[model samples]
Target: MSGAVQAKGGSRHGDPNRLGHGEVPASERGPASKRIVVSYGFWIFLLSDFVMFSGFFAAYAVLVGNTAGGPSGRELFDLPLVAAETAFLLLSSFSCGMAGIAAAARNAFWFQVAMAVTALLGAAFLALELYEFVHLIGEGAGPDRSAFLSAFFALVGCHGLHVVLGLLWLTTMMAQVWAKGFREDILRRITCSALFWHALDIIWVALFTIVYLLGSGAGA
Candidate 1:
């Protein structure tokens, strides 16, 4: 009887069903570690991307005046169109934020919808940008015609490439969510992509201000 009692006592003291001392349950581990890893990885990527943009910016600063006495920023830039493009991109960032909120809430349907809306807004912004480029080129202002035009095209085109790549990344994330049903990995990737997209939008705002606004007044 004493042995059986001791066994019972041991079971209570060393309960297999209980959490071990100073141990965390898997569910309670939280996403902090994952967030840190992801944030670090994204920062590295952003740094690399910024390096590429810096090269383009330097090239533009050097060649912005080789306009061959042709149209310059003041003559080419339509402030109204640029303003509209900025609005679309800013709104797209807002939509991406909404999608992130939905993902955090585990609301799959709303997350998909928000992502779709963000993509549409991004597409609209791209369309406007492409139209601006084409219009400039059509007026004998092609990049090959002048160093100024080449630099302008290269800087703006590189930015547009990023936008296009971001849209592709966004689309892939949406598809992954549909296939995986909000798995932790998918959510993390989506969060990273959202950060990247929003960062691009912010960078574009600065570029637009510098290239179109300040540069427009350079030779005036």
Candidate 2:
């Protein structure tokens, strides 16, 4: 009779959340881990960006030849200048990877250094792009000049705008890291930024190939 009561008490008073001495039931546990939540949600955001860019790509493709008798990409694009810009952006991506590694190791100094390098390279790429735009506008190849130019500016300019936003984000992340060490949330933020920067790098590479190299070949 005593054993039966003790068993009954154990059943009633023991961890009600557990299942046969196993881990607690997931339903009773808290929300999903922050890593899964952040990464998964951010991937959705990136996919939406990809969709937007894909639309721009399609528009550019259709309108590429519809220059309204104006200059084509081959005549206007400076491959040398674009190659330099590509180098800077590619280097920035490498630096961003280094920064991510530093963040994982929780090395504040290296993280800052890598992030600074990334910012500098990204800025250089942006500066070059701005210069190219200014030169093109001065040459009367502005977006208003032709449908082709308009599409060109829209596609390339959109990417430049992203880079500008990324720079701002990078600055903010640096400030956060300085104010607070490599906290979990901050590291997640850094990871997202790195992903964003890498995405830009990839888009730029495609831009270089299609809009620069191929376009230049066509006009030549």
Candidate 3:
């Protein structure tokens, strides 16, 4: 009887030192269980965000020719400036990638530096973009003056808003890293941020090509 009791106890508490025994596989865990809600949520947010851009593209398609005797893309768009903006955004994306690599390696200092660099680049892009908008508006080419300008402002401004939001997110994540160290949750958040930043870069490339290159051709 004593031996049977001991045997049962051993089976019931087998390997008390074992971690996550008889639990769900890591990959099979739900988003909540794995603390991946932010990762999954960010992707959904991106998709919904893209829908807004799609609407803007449709509007631009309809209003591309409505120059209203002010100025068209060929007259207003400085391709070199737009190209510089593209390069800044692209570099930011690259920095974000480096941040992810640092996060994965658990190097907190390098990760923060990379994130800071990305934020600076994003800020520079926003500055250039706002300057272009202000310059255009100053020259009697405000959005309200023409359907084409209105569509252009709406599309581009929305993208700029996203960049601003992304910068805020990056700032928050940096703080989180500083407070919590490079835990798995923080690393996942950083990874999601990287994905989001890169997505913006890709969207900007498309926007640059369609709004700048194609618009210039149409105006010419």
The per-prediction tally of clashing pairs is 0, 0, 0
- Best-to-worst ranking by lDDT: 2, 1, 3
TM-score of each: 0.82, 0.87, 0.83
| RMSD vs true structure, all candidates | 7.0, 4.9, 6.1
Cα deviation at 130, candidate 3, in Å, is: 0.9
lDDT (CA) for every model shown?
0.89, 0.92, 0.88
For residues 109-149, write the lDDT of model 1, one tens digit per residue. Answer: 99999999999999999999999989888988889888988
Worst 10 residues of 3 by lDDT: 15-24
Q: How accurate is candidate 1 locally (lDDT)?
A: 0.89
Q: Where does model 1 exceed 4 Å of error?
A: 1-35
Put down candidate 3 lDDT per residue, 35-141, tens digits, no spaces.
55676777898898788789999999899899887788988898889988999999999899899888888899999999999999999999999999999999999
Write down the TM-score for model 1: 0.82
On TM-score, the candidate that comes out on top is: 2
- The superposed Cα distance between candidate 2 and the true structure at residue 42, in angstroms, equals 0.4
Number of the candidate with higher lDDT, 2 or 3? 2
